[model samples]
Target: MSNKKMSGFTIVELLVVLSVIALLLSIITPRYFGKIKEGQEVVLKQNLATIRHAIDQYYSDQGMYPTNLNSLKEKRYLRDIPEDPIMKNQEWQIIKAPNEVGVYDVKSRSNEISSNNNMYSEW
Candidate 1:
């Protein structure tokens, strides 16, 4: 048989390919993570707004904010309380005005910082 070698990537070529892939991943991972965080923030904001609206409506119907979020469920204002994605099913922060009829403050259960570097709790 004739002496010959089948064509295939050399060790150096394989190393180069791996290096390129690692570099690409290093560059892309942070951006992808940032997008995921942004998506979470958007979802959190929407959920908070929805709950706030429901609380307002509850007040309009009943003339006062429920003693607690559970009251919403008792009154069937919501099928169930929406869990905070970041907090993984923890109760959200809720603040009621001393003499007002509805919620004056609502915030995420997760304390994740936003793009502006403000904690979700302070939003």
Candidate 2:
């Protein structure tokens, strides 16, 4: 009878591999989520711009701001209200120009601070 050692990973080797994976995940997870958040912020800004432009076009043609965002959609100035990427909804902070009766501008309603240290609501 001949005795031979089995070729396999030791318990210590498995633990070391798991530890390395965990370390890598710890380093990568935060950055990944942060990048995602930044992308969402960018999308929010673009959505605001698109909505603003639609309002401008509506005014240019109709001679007054749309009464509401849905009016833009009804008039075909926009296919739809752009979603607020950060807030994950179409709810927006509609701004009327100082006593104007209709929306003159729009902003994000997100309370989360952006990477630039500005509150999303300020954008």
Clashing pairs in 2: none
List runs of model 1 lying over 4 Å from the truth.
100-104
lDDT of 1 by residue, 75-116 (tens): 998888887877877488889878775465578866667898
Please give the lDDT score at residue 107 for candidate 2: 89
Local distance difference test, per candidate?
0.82, 0.88
Top candidate (TM-score): 2
lDDT of 1: 0.82
How does residue 52 of candidate 1 score in lDDT?
A: 85
RMSD of each: 2.1, 1.5
lDDT value, candidate 2, whole model = 0.88
TM-score for each candidate, following the candidate numbering: 0.86, 0.92
